[model samples]
Target: MSQHHAPRQYLNWLASLGLLLLLGLGVELLLQQYGLRQQQAEQQRLLAHANEVRAVLLGELNATLHLATGLASYIPARQGRIDTAELEPWLQGLFQQGRYIRNIGLAPDNRIDFLYPLSGNEAALGLYYPDLPKQWPTIQRIIASAQPRLDGPLQLVQGGRGLIYRVPVFLADQRYWGLISTVIDFDRLFAEVEAVARQRGLAIALLPLDAAQQLALTSTPDTELHLPVFLAGANWQLQARLLNPQPPLLRGLRLVGWGLALAVSALIGMALHSQQRKTSLLLALSQSQRDFLQAFELAPQGMALLDAQGRLLAVNQALCRLLQQSPTQLLQRSVMQLCVPAEREQLQVRLATLRFGHNDSWFLQLLDGQQQQIAVECSAAILGQLGSASEVRILHVQDMRERLRLQRLQSEFTASVSHELRTPLTAIAGALGLVNGGALGEVPAAMRELLQIAQANSQRLQELINDLLDMEKLLAGKMRFEAREQPLWSLLQEAVLHNQPYAAQHQVQLQLLGPPCQVAVTVDGQRLAQVLANLLSNAAKFSPPGSSVEVAAVVQGGHVRVSVRDQGPGIGENFRARIFSKFTQADASDCRQKGGTGLGLAISKELIERMHGRIGFDSVEGQGSTFWFELPISVTKPQDAST
Candidate 1:
């Protein structure tokens, strides 16, 4: 009877194998369908976003063109000696209707005929702001083509932000009178793309003129993402990628759900007919075990099974390929042997933190068989195998050395370039400051104007250099903080006094308020002074003559808080988000009209943080802005403290 049942058992096992194969096929088919659907949905969403942005941009472009054409016709009506007093105010009103528009200017005859946030029609009536100064070729191109072009990832003449926008204008019988362009906050607009992507849990990046990995849209201080991303939507290439892992498994299960029902029904029918239920169940268990083994061996990542004591129990083929060594040589090695000698202890501690059932992922500079320090990311899980009494630890390691190397190189290059540029900038700025301050003696109006231009550009250059340097330091973790005991109130008073004359020159009232006592902080004196100076300078720049700038410092929550409030045209809500961003000015027209580089607030923020402090600001449009920062309380260092 036993011999007769053997073939029957074999037949039952084959049936189970057949069911497993069917299940596998169903899973694959379902996964494919799911992936296809996901791709289609993503594509549709991207297309929609692109269309929306395109529509908005087109509307803005058309609005400006209509306004410019209207303004240009007025110039001809007045026989080319246009009086902005009649037309500029109307254009300013047009600009105020759009939230994204920073400032709009109408330039005629290759000069700024009128530019705004009109104190009146005369605000920049005769002033040719460099950023808004007539882009003659651009105007000619528009006149020549009448077709709109996205002119930049260039700094906006208005707010000093890098931009890309639509330009269209009017012409008289093929003569380029002037052009109208809309300055879009390209970065912020890109964020809108990111926000949509984020809603769907995706990664997004905006490339510079079709070059991805140039700069990132995300706000992380110094992340260098080098991955290539292309968005088929928007006709604008994408520098962003989004990843979601949940769908693949969900799709597979959908397929498996269908197949499992059929297999189970078949199994029950066969059992009832042949009296082979026991044999079928055993075969099912074996097939399941075999499938698990296949998944393990063919894993995409390097997989290693190590004992509780850190000895490698087994290395999969993936692991062998990664380490560039055979499994035989790796068998007795400790998990720590894969890491750099200095980092082994940390890895061991992290590994020990893993309980019998848990795991975590972390990154490190690890050593491979070639003895190279390669950047690697490891994810580990503790598992229990039936043959082993102790739980085994499985780790998956992937090499990220290339990515790390690229980031490091960028950081180093940024630092080197900043330093190289600073020397000349320092000399130039000092010269300009001296000339502007009468250190170079009295000057004629023409000479003074020329010097002013040079001085302004120098300041812009300095700001850019400083921003680069600060970014580099932040990236390299070379940012140094100096904290020392100091009278906080006294420092605030000193800052106000130093800026007093400067404020008077701008006709802004400077006031200081603080108790005549010691409210000290442990912070860098020079850096603190810099923060205060920058705040005061910005206040002076924006404040109207006769308006007051309040400077106050107080002890709040065991920290020293200082603020500078300016009564001026308030910061617009649109520009507030990037108030601390480098190389960005508050308004498009203001950026080109005013001479200061846009790096001040960014530098101040970095400086304050390095001094164990934080900075912030508050503002409202047409009401002005208030800037402030906090530093830890001054403390007495004991003699035993290490240097």
Candidate 2:
């Protein structure tokens, strides 16, 4: 028997070794994938940084070069004549505005004629362009092409390295005049670029495309992104890379993966060689039970284990504190004893169903140790095999008193504020109306216009307050509706007439279309009219001037569908989900331009739903939108209504 078991032990060892190899391979593959993703993300980030640096460099170069162009334009407007008194101040202004300009020079007939601030730049004065063999060809090219060119990060006669932006001037009759050269301090400009790169922990280089202009700036290796920079008829390449390319955390993760594989393999091998399989299994089960008990004890909500008979097997601390009872006093006690007598029978019936594998949740009132009732939401589920003698159930209870109390307080506050503001607003509106109507005597024309404006604003404010009150009443379950069978056509006609003046104010026409039919629906007439008015006014406001808004109705199966279509910019994809939310507008500027409190749609939706209907809309971004609502048709037909 010992010899036969030896081979079985060797097989188990071999299996453990194979498991280790598989786990190691999987971990290595996962690490490689993660490393590749990190490298790609880093490259993308570096590319963005390189583009930003290129834009800043180009912006600085263009701004400095614009001064040269401005001077060229100014010289020609003066008919190719440069006056010291007029030209000095202009050049001084340009120099002060341009932070990176070294100096400005005007070369007439291919010779340096005038220099701004001749203190340090006196050496550059009276120098002929033809005398400098290196720059003469570039200046000649600028004059022939009649275009601007940026050249040189070369040594300047005035001292430091500088770039020259040369703009050729011409007369009104297209005669060649001279060149306006603006010297830019190359070192100062690049200092700013370097500062930005250092802030992002990146190294950057700028390489000119022209090989003849061999001025290249570079840093370390490991190039990541190469972006093009175009300015003043010259192209250059910008390269960027991260300072610390590889992160240390990735290396640490690789080492951790290998160590975990080795540890797992050694544990399995030891377990196999022990020859006490039952002892090892028991140890694992004990550990799992301990973990579960620790989690149950620390849970925030009340939790408990109950036997098949509904007696408490074990209770966590949260449950003990919730009931104001100790574990010693609550052990083996029936959980139903904690509920009020009025609800105990119902609770028992629900708990009995848990054994049959039916999970349930319901609201209940529990009595604490002092016999005080507490409102709670309770749920139960079977914890073990169904119908087994040792089966247990888990119960979860959450207190709901605080949530209900806060809701009541919020509703009361909204009602109080809306009522208080409506009274004063009504009085102000009435006074303005009387004054504008000449009831207080003949008024000046200017004062009458001001009074009318005040009246309009007061009216808008009053409408907003009314919408708030209606919304509050609906949310509080206090809005009363008088439902009756009514013809939908008459309601639509009344809404059209009511909103005609509003549509005319926005210069949009309203058209009522569809085949004539006597479709009646059971709804509150007043509320239904309000919903129609909201859709009509909204469509009219958004429609372009002279565009038409169409109101139509159709019957489908057992419901009547009413639609309001408009020729207006449709809703955006991002804002469509929140279109009916409280105080939400597609754009904030729409509130001031379109004149709304942003609560119209929300109130309309609530009112329609309260009247037993559904409201929705369909829209394409640029075409337009159609708002529609459906209401169940009344059982009483039109002919029956006449009876």
| TM-score per model over all chains | 0.41, 0.48
TM-score of 1: 0.41
Backbone atom clashes (below 3 Å) for every candidate = 9, 0
Model 2: what TM-score? Answer: 0.48
Worst 10 residues of 1 by lDDT: 219-228
The lDDT of model 2 is 0.83
Runs with alpha carbons beyond 4 Å of true place in candidate 2? 1-295, 303-315, 323-397, 441-453, 589-592, 639-643
For candidate 2, lDDT tens digit of each residue in 486-573? 8888788888898989999999888889575477888898998888888999999999999999998888888888999999999999
In model 2, what are the clashing residue pairs, if there are any?
Answer: none
